[model samples]
Target: MSEQSLFERIGGREAVEAVVGSFYEAVAGEMSLRVLYPEDLTPSREKLEYFFEQWLGGEPRYSERYGHPRLRRRHFPFVIAEHHAQLWLKHMRSALELQQIEREDFDSIWGRLESLANHMVNAHEEVPREPLPEDAWLT
Candidate 1:
């Protein structure tokens, strides 16, 4: 028989769902990261569940529903700098650890996540420009 996919080995849909839920819970406490997420997390949770299912070698439901994930493009509207990526990874790591998964499986999954998160950085820190003084306006 063919070997089961990582998704299956990791306990399939239920596990992925649990991980997504826990991950969001962790993100809630990250003040800087919170601005990147929507006020209502339901949509975020659903998209993540579907994306992980497809990415982990299960059915391609995410693609079917949303077309190509185009993850980086989708994230472009947000300012995902290195600091944001690190915060994201931090929460994700905590969530994954809570699962008590096998070490090998954890390493494999974390590696992929790290690569993806690193690729998501699209901006860098810069000082905010001060508003022009009212008197500077042309009469």
Candidate 2:
């Protein structure tokens, strides 16, 4: 017989939803991450719920509803530098801890997500622009 999916091992749909919700809550606290999302995070939260559900091997709700994930392609618009990816993982790690999952299960999930976060980096950070010498500024 096949091994149980991470979804099942972690207690299925409700667990996934809880973890996703926690992840978003953590993400909300960070201004750097918060800037990437819309003011209203309801839609974003739902999308992540559906995505984590399928990604953890529960069901294909996300793909069925939104077509192929195209995760990297979809995230291309954002300038995801190394630090951004690390912050994303930090929030995700906190969310996973809130679930109190087993070590192996955590490893399985964490490994995949870490890879995904790193992969999402589409650009590097450039130096900040200098301010004009004059405070008066141009019209």
Candidate 3:
């Protein structure tokens, strides 16, 4: 029998969207990683969910809309360092675990995300930027 595609093993578009939603929820809650997201996660979540859905083999919507991911180019403006990459992977790992996705599928997804995160690093030192106030709900 042919091996199942990662998308098939993970339950396709619906499942991937659920996982993305959960992962973003964790990101929205974290202090350090929160800044990577916009003030609202709705748009970001939609983009990622669609991206993964196409990437994992569900549909071509992402590429059709965005015309090549160009993940690094899109993320070049962000200051992702080793620590941030680790934290981002940590949350994603947790979300996959919580979804009860198979280990192999999880590893595959993590490996891609880790690679993308590593490539997203644009600066060695953190750039000076205004800090979010304690009461700020959005990063």
After TM-score superposition, the amount by which residue 23's alpha carbon in candidate 1 deviates from its true location, in angstroms, is: 0.6
Q: Write the per-residue lDDT of candidate 3 for residues 32-84, one digit (tens) a residue.
A: 98977779889788888878887887777777777767666565556777888
Q: Which parts of model 3 are misplaced by more than 4 Å?
A: 1-4, 125-139
- State in Å the error of residue 90, model 1: 0.6
Cα lDDT of all candidates, in order?
A: 0.82, 0.80, 0.76
lDDT of 2 by residue, 1-139 (tens): 9998888888888888887788889888999989987788888888888888899888888887777787776676567789999999998888888886899989989999999999888786443233222111122
Model 1 Cα lDDT, one tens digit per residue, 1-139: 9999989988899999999999998888788998888798887888899899999999987888777777776666677889999989998898878786888988999999999999888786342334323122211
Highest TM-score scorer: 1
Q: Record all residue pairs in model 2 with backbone atoms less than 3 Å apart, i.e. clashing.
A: none
Give the runs in model 1 whose Cα sits over 4 Å from its true position. Answer: 125-139
> What's the count of clashing pairs in each model shown?
0, 0, 0
Q: Candidates 1 and 2: which is better by TM-score?
A: 1
RMSD of 3: 6.7
Q: Candidate 2: misplaced stretches above 4 Å? A: 1-3, 125-139
**lDDT (Cα) of model 3:** 0.76
lDDT of 1 at 7: 90
